[model samples]
Target: MTIYRELVIHLKEETMKDIELLVIYQNAKTLLFHDSKQTNTIEDFVTGCIHHYIDRVKHQIDLSGINDLGKPYRLQNHLKEYIDKKGISQAMLAERTGIGASNLSLIMKNKNQPSLDYFFRIWIALECPPLDKILYRVEE
Candidate 1:
């Protein structure tokens, strides 16, 4: 059988058991076999897979609404959680806010802090509520 066919069968079986495991399988398989630009070393492959898995778990946490009240409002964490919950892609947000994709990525990663103007633009673009737990809250 072809590799793709084998992967399909394996994924089908995995999906019947756990969706998270299926996602991990698919990501690791793609990184190992499909990407031409992936690093050659086993260490790099393992590290990349771990990073990919962590990112997926983080997204799942956001999607699952783990937003605890009274936590400090962090722009990167809150923005990512909001966007994930609302099913908004970074590319879509960038287009809506008139920010470049790279800039938006940096903001999301907390590598760069957006200006107040950009924050307002993001708020408007995301259509966030004024008193949103993740996005904003009025301090007493």
Candidate 2:
């Protein structure tokens, strides 16, 4: 089998057990796997899988809705807070990250989901320590 097929199989065996993965896989498979005429490269499959995972995670979070008591945190809010605390403007952040100010605003407003590259750029611009703290948290 090709590397792409192998990766799909591996993900199915190892990661599909999780509900999140299952949803992601189903959505990704529907959207990406249908195009058999396209190149069946490992990179293609991996990219699709990664996108699926992101979509699934976003969907799950959206289903939960915004917490009124501020129990659950969001990346947009975290970024805004960081910007406020650091007294940095969006234009400054955009310059530091090499992203357009409008793009940064869209991301901050949660109107667009940034790719990993953009995320890293923002992270580095913020100089946030304990990166995991910014990315995730334990439910109380």
Q: TM-score of each candidate?
A: 0.40, 0.40
- What value does the lDDT take at residue 29 in candidate 2? 76
Clashing pairs in 2: none
Whole-model lDDT for model 1 versus the true structure? 0.65
* Candidate 2: residue 101 lDDT (0-100): 84
How badly does each model clash, as a count of residue pairs?
0, 0
Model 2, 22-131: lDDT tens per residue? 55565567668786433334445567778988966665543232444467644433576668777999989989999998888987776675789999899877885344
Q: How accurate locally is residue 90 in candidate 1, as Cα lDDT from 0 to 100?
A: 97
Question: At residue 74, what lDDT does model 1 achieve?
Answer: 45
**Regions more than 4 Å wrong, model 1:** 1-77, 135-140
Q: Candidate 2: TM-score?
A: 0.40
lDDT of 2: 0.65
Compose the digit string of candidate 1's lDDT tens values, residues 1-140: 65522222233654545655555576678788998444244334445676888966665433222255565544433687778889999999999999999998988876777898988899889785332334432222
lDDT by candidate, in order shown: 0.65, 0.65
